[model samples]
Target: MNTKLMGSALIISGTALGAGMLAIPMVLAQFGLLYGTLLMVLIWFGTTYSALLLLEATIKSGGGLGLNSIARKTLGKGGQLLTNGLLYALLICLLMAYILGAADLLVQAASALGLELTFMHSQIIFTLTTGVIVACGTGVIDKLNRLLFFVMLASLLMTLAVLLPEFSTDNLSQVSNSDHIGLIKTSAVLFTSFGFMVVIPSLVSYNSEASDKQLRNMVIVGSIIPLVCYLCWLFAVVGNLPAGQLKEFASVSELMAGFEHDAPWVGGFLSVFTGLALLTSFFGVAMSLFHQNSDTFNQNRVVTYVLTFVLPLVGAILAADQFLSVLAYAGIILVFLAVFVPLAMVYKLRLANALPERYTAEGGNVMMVFALLFGGFLLASQVI
Candidate 1:
């Protein structure tokens, strides 16, 4: 693989796997192993397809602009404003979610070492760590992400390997009542889980020199890693937990805590891995948000720095206890902005240009309609 391709893959993979991994097992556990794994795959496809749609839109529009610019071009000024607002809100929510998760991990680590700290103190530490990383600039974040991505993959594999022996086929048979509710309720978690798709356009814009085939390949390869990781994680946790207990623990930390009680090293290792995963995500979002904000305000570094660093930390502190709930709620808005709207743009472009040679939609109107309907249904269900 080309060096740039490798770097892009790491960036994409790291961005996708962040924070979501920590919550996947618990989300999947709600619906049992088999069903949850299947749901995850469905989510992966939906998210990936949406991302491709966005990429197609980006390509047709000349490919340099970020999502906000594309939305403005396709949707007009009002549309642009709405999209920008949604993007900002979504980024803020994501920032808060990551910070909150990091703070929780730090607190857990401190508690494990017999040093009890208040949530605020932990939040401060988490914020500062993230701020320092952000302040170091994109080059530093990119470099760190490259190394951390490998460490993250290794830690994930190692943790999964240790838990594999304990996997139970009987647990896979158990199904969550929520799955019967169809994609609606399931989408709450799925949309949020797959929200990283929003970063795809940004990724494409960054790796502008990459060939079309290379971009597609990178996306496929990048997306698959997370799908496999999510499946393994679901298998490990869902198979290990009893059906009744699974409902009580809506967060992955609880499941990992159970594992930790039985296997301290495994739990500790996973916890650290989980923290790094969130950090990687935080870095990506911070970079993207900073870049977008900077571009919007005509590259005002001060505004970018302050918004990137401060907003998330404040949101995190305010939402320390309700981190997961906030994530679930944010999923509703994100599914529309991240998935639905972009799909529509792609479809519209496909029709306007009769099968254009470069960066065209694959299945024509049929695929476009499907993307629209599916994305719309997800958005509507969440609202109702």
Candidate 2:
């Protein structure tokens, strides 16, 4: 892969492997290994397809523009409003997840070092630290992302290596054939883990010089990393914990506690992995939020600061539990904006006879129709 393409791939993979990864074992453990793994792969395929569609829309647009700009150019005012609104909501929900996730891990880390801190205090501190880093702008975030991504990868490998010895196929057969409600909820939670859309538009601008082929390869490869990672993570986690205990796992920490029971080293390593995952995601999401305010809208820095970081921080603190719930909600909403809207942009472009000669999306209307049905089915599953 080209260095630029590799970097782009890492960004997408990093964002996808956020708190949602940590939260995965909690939600999916109930659906058991078989059903949960299948649902995750399905969602991954859909998310990857949607991300490529978004990429196609971005390429058709000139360059250096975000999703809102592309939607406006392609879909008119209503499209712009819908795309931007959903993007803002999606980003805020994501930031909220990171804030709570970071705070939880920070508190655990501090206690391990014998320096106790409350969740609220750790959250406030994390907010301040993130605010400072995000203020430095996208260039800094991109550079920092590359370095932290390696650490995140290392931490993940360490966790997996430590737990692999404990893995048992005994847990893989636990399946729920009659519990559709539980299965649906599990799918909703897993949906949030595939959070690659928020950064897709940014990737186009980040690698403006790269060809369509390079970008598509990067997106596909990037999405694949998370799928593989999630598969490993779910296999290890579900295999290690009993079905009875997993059904009662109130949070990810509880799930980790179960893992740590057998492997003492897992506790500290998981904290590091989870924290790094949260930060990697935080940087990408914060940059996208900030850039939208500053570069896209020409808003004041302070205004952007509040909207991008502070507001979500407040929201996360006020209703941390609800923030997790909104991850599922936002994942559902993202189907329309991230999946359908991009497909809409393409169809609109085609119908209007406005497709630039340099189009890159494959399958044309056939692919669009297929993706639309896929997204609709995914959305319907969550709703029903």
Number of the top TM-score candidate: 2
lDDT of 2 by residue, 24-114 (tens): 8767776667677778888888778878887877777664536777878888898889888888888888888888778877887788789
lDDT, candidate 1, 15-126, per-residue tens: 7776677666555576666566666777788777777777777777665435677876677788778878888888888888887777778878898799989878988887
Model 1: colliding residue pairs: none
Clashing residue pairs, backbone N/CA/C < 3 A, model 2: none
TM-scores for all candidates: the values are: 0.92, 0.94
In candidate 1, residue 111 scores what lDDT?
89
Report the lDDT of model 2 for residue 375. Answer: 78
